[model samples]
Target: MNDQAARLRRMIEDKHPRSDNKSNNIQENSKPEKLSANRGPRTIAITSGKGGVGKTNLTVNLAIALGNMGKRVIIIDADMGMANVDILLGTTSRINLMSLLESDVALEDVLLRGPYGVSYISGGSGMEHAMELTSTERDILFRKLAGCEEWADIILIDTGAGIGGNVLDFISAADEVLLITTPEPTALTDAYAVMKGYSSISDNPNLKLIVNRVIDEPEIREVVGTLSRTAERFLKISVECLGYIYDDQMMIKSVRQQVPVMAGYPESISSRCILSIAKGLLNGHQEKVKLGWRGFLKRIFRS
Candidate 1:
């Protein structure tokens, strides 16, 4: 792992000369413009209004599943203060992303490679400060990540729970927001709250939902139906239901063993559900935000 970290660091420093802060800071203006629209990086953020809805598990497995579809997937542990995606993957990160904001660690120094040949950047505990980037810093960080667009077909950000600034920033900046929830009433309400927050902030109307831990079809329909109506009534927005994953004990067992359920027990019911969701995402079957960085910037800086 140490050797891989060193190699990543060397690769970044040698190729990216502008990252002179030892923190992988790239000069925004100097960045080569995104050349073509030939399948650019698909940034998908997996977030929930409340925690304990298996958001991290969904993010991990989805990324791996996408990798299985022959796409170069990169998962970002964007949870900031309470990240644990590394735990689920059974790998200890030598240099987490917090080092880049706190100390002078390069961004390349922080990424940890995971199973199924996926690369990830750990958000680390106490990364809230990094979330508050100045405009210059924000541009730099985004541009640096944009460089990874060449290497990744999809970038999944496992965002922290709730509607906090970190979560909002992560989701709003993403190409699409994947809202994960269960059939619980509270989860439904929180999902509405998240959509409301998004509607209030930006007009980049693209939010997808994943109903997890389902046991009954009627109950799941009731929950999703309620959410859809609430959005239509208040926010005047709609949520695309990606799919549902049933409550399979194999999910729990895989977590206990620090492996994603998809890889540990691909034949499980939950795994099948996750695969269905992944297919819709990777094949572009669902709606997508048509906005580019300029549009996102306008939304971000709008009054």
Candidate 2:
């Protein structure tokens, strides 16, 4: 193995050292079988085909909306090199996932609490190292992440834009993938490309689209219809419209102030749109697929 891989393996083995034979036998005998579906936290990856489409904004506000509804939510800023979740929330972390992986710091030590009772883990620049993690290392990392399942009902991953390998790995591993786009032709084209790319690689990928910056209901329907029809026809995949956010000045103001629109302007049109989407998800308006964290890890290592 190369230097990076060797370092990663050492980190994993050190974090979870093997037990003696007698202790291992006793532990194996006492451990219970894995629980059935619908047990662990739900994981949703918010991504886009291209950048500057308000994907992170939606992730932050949507997570707060869910938290307001009494759901325990954690947002993992998985954008890697271009992380801005901390900037959007107006907070700073002395450590991030990279610090945890490369050193002995515990994962909980790196978790930062954001506004509205939502917890988040900043990916920082360590995401580049994630792409190089061997299968064994990834499994160990996922097992470490599984600990977060105890404290959250929902884990929302804010993935980087575009179809890079890191982005694809996170999307494919998520229980649900929320693809955000604008009304622009380029955004729509890239959104379709993301759906097509994911469809080709994953079996029955749970995909949903959120149209941002819509001017009116007519425009929303038109945009959703066009994309939905194209995806159904060309990709042979079904893309559901989770919801849309209207273009609003309050949203821009909130961003400038480093507060989520949901918290700063709950009565704003954009806030209402995000709340409606959160309610839709909670009410089971969307299809139910419970992969949980273990399944997510399996998919990640397999990829």
Candidate 3:
């Protein structure tokens, strides 16, 4: 195998030890098959209760960190109306998802390669137009996305903020959701609003919190603890603390440079935090659900 594939194999072995053949056989036979073998990548939706909580920043950097660890990562800039992922990566896309939906363009044609070999689909204003697509058109879009399953190990959907129908559709379809928030009261409240809204519609949504722009350890604990407690108490949902990003100047500099901090300043505090979160994801700190692209498409198009 090549170096990257070999490294990925080693990481997977270290994280998920081999089970005995007999036990593995028994487990396989005992469980009902839910996901298809063609369902290749794990879909993760990174969203927030409101905008300006650094959702896109975290999404881009986290994808880069995961890619550095030998995982093939694809980021879908699902914020169709106000897509800035291309701007953030300092790369311009000649076409976006809109082109795919409106014409005979293939998925690969719309994908843009960003820094650190990360591939992304810029939604541009196409996402705003997605909700109005006819049934056949929506099915075509989903099938195109499903074709990406073989190319990525992880698909990060950087969804638009707030409790819009499109945002909820993407979040509900994902295997897991990472809710981003800051210590600001409004941010926290909006985050809670998102959780509450989601709980009302979906059953047992996999929700995790990423506290961004934390100034100190105490602030991290305070924000995470308060949000966790509120989610459990009111929504009856258990919110896992994925990780936190510190308030670092390097992040601002990286943004100005239009590069992810993980690529621009690997040693920066925020970059390190993103690496930690990626490790947490790989180490199975959260539950692994069988939901994949096919299931995601079903959920999205049905709604």
lDDT of 3 by residue, 95-131 (tens): 7777767555766567666656667888876555666
The 10 consecutive residues of candidate 2 with the worst lDDT sum are 29-38
Candidate 3 total steric clashes: 0
What TM-score does candidate 2 get on C-alpha atoms? 0.83
Better of 1 and 3 by lDDT: 3
Q: Candidate 3: TM-score? A: 0.84
Best by lDDT: 3
lDDT of residue 155 for candidate 1: 76
What TM-score do all the candidates reach, one by one?
0.79, 0.83, 0.84
| Candidate 1 lowest-lDDT run of ten | 23-32
What does the lDDT read for residue 86 in candidate 2?
81
lDDT tens per residue, model 1, 234-303:
9988777888899899999999999899999999999999999999886665555454333333333331
Each candidate: RMSD = 7.4, 8.7, 10.6
Report clash pairs, candidate 3: none
lDDT of 2 by residue, 91-187 (tens): 7766677665554555555666665666788877655466577766665566566656655778898988889757887888888999999999999
Q: Whose lDDT is higher: candidate 2's or candidate 3's?
A: 3
